[model samples]
Every structure is written in structure tokens, then in C-alpha cells.
Target chain A: MFKNGKCIFIAFILSLLATPIMVAAEYGDVLINNYSDEAGMRPVVFPHWFHRIRFRCKVCHADLGFKMEAGGNQINMLKIIDGEYCGACHNGEVAWAVENCDICHTGKPGQPTQVHQSTASKLTTTTKRKQAESVE
Target chain B: MKFKHSLYILPLSLSFALLAAEPSWRTLVEDGLHDPTSPAIGVLQEPASALSLLPPDTTGNQVSWIRALREGYIEPRTNILPETKIEVLDMDIIMEKTGELSLVMFPHKPHTEWLDCANCHDKIFVEKVDANPINMFAILSGEYCGQCHGAVAFPLTECNRCHSVARSSFTGKPGVQPISVSD
Candidate 1:
């Protein structure tokens, strides 16, 4: 019984350590809601992971003039279409077009379903359905 | 008697003329429009040119504190590697540690110029909003900011440099003023 209790205590400590990691994973992944709610549209889930892999931090931040603070950059659909903000690379030829709103606007602010569509698909049942519904 | 009256009348008329010659609102407006060098000009309002206000090396460098510390001036070097490149981004994250204390203004541009993303990301600071507690106590003991600040970067003694979010109600304590680049 003594050995079992010690093992349980160590397991508890390990779980506590893991909790922060889970939360930290979501960092830098921003919810771009500059004018989304005001315009009756969903806020965008701009995955830093997705973009960071393909491009250096300088590409979007320095050359493309993206503010480091998420949503700090003045991003608009019109600007993207004009090849200004997200439009710089999201033009049909370079990457996915800005017309694909559902890709970025996958997260809901208060709802538990507020994970990125790409990640949501891999997660359990509810988030996957949420992504599908958002597409629809 | 006629000469005395003429002298008094001449003086009174001249006085009125002088009073009228003093600049009117109309004249001031006209002067502002026509004269680019007028006191009313926006740029001229500041006595020194914008470039002159910054350090010589940082004049056109967009004011990176990290760069100024490393290359512009020398001090006791830290073990950590310094960042290269002159890239600057003029954005600040205002962190409200406590309602009583002033908020911290985290400027990223200069830091990014010096260090890689991995240096602090996920390790020291979890690149998320409202994630790190980042209190002064922890910082003093060598946690979040103490990771580099006291060790290599500017020491935490410079309190006002980070806690520089402007608040109307705040009557700042000594050494708690906003970080001005001129210093």
C-alpha cells in the first residue's frame, strides 16, 4: 500500500507538469478578430505553426509588415486580395487563396470547439464535427 | 494752442495704429499657411529633428535597444549569444502585472533582431497572451526576464524601461517613467 501511494504521488506531480505544456501549445496561435464579430463573421484562427514552418519569422513580420502581436497587424480581406497583408502569399498561385474563409475562421471564441481546423480534424469527435459544420 | 492739440492727436492716432499692427487671428493663420518654417508647423514644434533624438548608430535603425546595447555601446558581456540583423518592428505588448503597478511594454522588434525565436519561445516565455505571470518578484530571482536581463541584457534596475504603458491616473514614482530612446 505504501509503494502504491508513492507511485500515485509521483504520477500526480508528472500530470501537473504536463498541464502547462498542453496550454502552452496554443501560444502564438492567434484568433484574428480585428473586425470579424462586428461584421457578423467568425474570427480567424491563424496557425503560427502552419505559417512558421513554410516561412521565416521575417517574411511575414519584417518584409510583409506583420505586427508580432497577433491581430496587431491590420489584416483585412480586401488587403489580402490586393496582395498586402495575408494576400502577399495567399494569392491563388503561391498558397491557398484568401477566398477560403473557412480555413482560417474555424475557431469560436467561447466554445470548446475553438481549435484550428487542421488540428481539430485529428482531435476527438466534437472538434472534428465543429470543423465540418464551420465548412458547411 | 493749435500745435498742442495737433501733438496730442498725432500721438493718439499713432498708438491706435500700433495696436492694430499687432498680429490678429487672420494674420496668424495666413502666416502659418504661407511659412513652412513657422512655429505652427508640426515638424518644427519639436526643437530637435527626429533623427537627432536617437543615438548616432540607431538614427536610421528604427531604435532597437538590443542593437544599441551590443554594437552601439559595450558593457560586461553575457554568456548568451547576441542577435544579428537590423530588422525592427515597432510593436509593444502591454502586460498588466497588477492593477496597482504600471503595465509592462514588451517591445519585440529589437529582441528579435538579436535572438532567434527558439531562444525564449516555449522555454522562458510561452509566446501566448496572458500565459506568463511575470511578476517583479520572479524576475528579481532570475526567472522570466532575469533569464537574460540582469545576466547579459540591461539589468532590472531600469524599472521604467519595461513598465512604460501610459495611464492617465498614474502619477509615476521615481525611476518608473516611460522608456524614452534618447537616454
Candidate 2:
């Protein structure tokens, strides 16, 4: 009985170790738990790869004054709608419309559904093309 | 002995009383010492001459002194000093008593581009004047401008490079007159 209890304890430790790796793999979306005492609102998970393909480093970094440090930009919902920060480009013209609540605040736990997979893929491809043109 | 035991107890009680009284004493002292400088201990003073080195204001120019200093800049210096010739503009300014003239113009922009911000911001300049006391003596002792001017950028051995006075021209400042070089 003692041996069986030891094995169970070891298994529990192993599962704890594996959980963080699984969390990191799901990088495309982030969970914002705002209701907790530490943070006030649900944070929208931002996909880095999606934006990297669309813009140059200088555009959002140097021009937009986004800090070199990650999560350094103090963004709020009001700022986005005013087309100041992320709204400057993501305002329907470049990516998705700010008015579309479900696009960002999707009630899901992880990556939101891309509305239509066909249109999402086309957008990604066009963005990649524009990035290439700017580089050249 | 009973007397010795009582003596130890007495000193211990006194010490405890002093410890308990410390907070109120500290508050009283802080209230008495209230001043702007009291709150900002160890904050360095800005140098008076910090902005004196900059060029004079030209009409209709809205550029800040820092931006003007960065203008006409070349790439920052790295491992190897690029073999590009530069034009040195000669100008005069009164530093102190007795018209103490010197070779004021230098190829500053090229060197500035290569340097990191920290290289000069805190070390070379005090956040505020009179906060970090700097003088020619400190500079000669390997502080501020002397940190690199004589060591890495260019040797202070060249006299005319800094002190362009006619008398000290031979030993302190050397070489030909200001000549332009092409990339």
C-alpha cells in the first residue's frame, strides 16, 4: 500500500511538470482572467505570428512607439476603438474591425475561430506578400 | 549576586524603552527636516555647463538642442574607425575670465552615433547641475569628457584637436588646419 501511494505521488509531480509545456504550446491565444483579485478584466490573447507577417518591425515599434519590452503597451478598449494604438491598423482596413466584439472578446478559452477559414488564409497570404514588398 | 542581576534587568528595560520611543522621535525629526531636497537624497544635480556646449538658437528653428546636436551625424563608431574625412568648423565662445580660446569644433556626430545612451547620459552628465559636481580637474582625472576623449575616441596627445590656442598650438594641438574629407 505504501508503494502504491508513492507511485501516485510521483505521477502527480510528473503531471504538474507536463502542464506548463502544454500551456506554452498553445501560444496563439492567451487567457485574460480579469475577474481575479490580481487582475481586473479578461485579457485578450494577442497572436504575435499573425501581426509579424503583416507589419515591419519599424512600423509598430518605432512609429507606433510600442516599447521593446513585451506587454509594455498599456492598451485599453477605449483606445482601440479610437484608432490610436492597435486600432490604427486593425480597424477593418488592415485586419478585423474594432466594432466586432466577438472577433477579440470571443468567450472561448483559447484561439478564437477565424470566422471563415478561407478568408483567414487569404488575409494571411496577402499580408505576407505586403511584408515581402516592403522588405524589397 | 542579586545586585548584578538587577543591574542587567535595568539596562535591558532602558534599551527596550529607547527602542519603543524611536518611531515617534523619527517622525518628529522628519517633520522638522521637511524640505524638497530632504526627500530627494542622492539624486545628482544637473551640470550648469551641460547645455552651454550647444550651438546658439537660429530664428525659425524649432529643433531642440539635443536634436540639433544629433544632426549632420554619421553612423556611430564601432570596432574600426571608418577612414572618412570630416570638416571641423572653428568657433569661439567665452568659457571663463580672460578670452580662453580653444579648438571648439570636432567631428562629434560620427562618434555620437556609435555610442550607447548610457555611455554619456548619467556618467558624463549629472541629472541636474550642482548635483554632480564636475570641473576640469575631475575631467583630467578620467571623469566625464576625459573618460573617452583622451583614451578611446582620440588621444589627448594631439593638442590642436582640443586646445586650438595659438601659443599651445605646437605641443597641445597638432596637425594641419581643418580640411574636409570624402567618404
- For model 1, name the residue pairs that clash: B83-B114
Query: In candidate 1, what are the lDDT values of residues B63-143, reduced to their tens digit?
Result: 233443446432312211134344444445666655665667677766665445555678779888778888777776557
Q: Which of the CAPRI classes, incorrect, acceptable, medium or high, describes model 1? A: incorrect
- Interface DockQ of each model: 0.01, 0.01
lDDT of 1 by residue, A36-114 (tens): 7777665665654335334545556545666444455778888888899788778887677877765555445332322
Q: Tens digit of lDDT per residue, candidate 2, span B1-183?
A: 999999999999999998665322112112211122232222311111222233333211111222433452112222221332223223222122113556333333443333433344565665443344544555544566555433223333444544444444523322322442211
The clash numbers for all candidates, in the given order, read 1, 17
Work out the TM-score per prediction: 0.32, 0.27
Please list the C-alpha lDDT of all candidates, in the order they appear. Answer: 0.51, 0.39
The window of 10 residues in a row where model 1 chain A has the poorest summed lDDT is A113-122
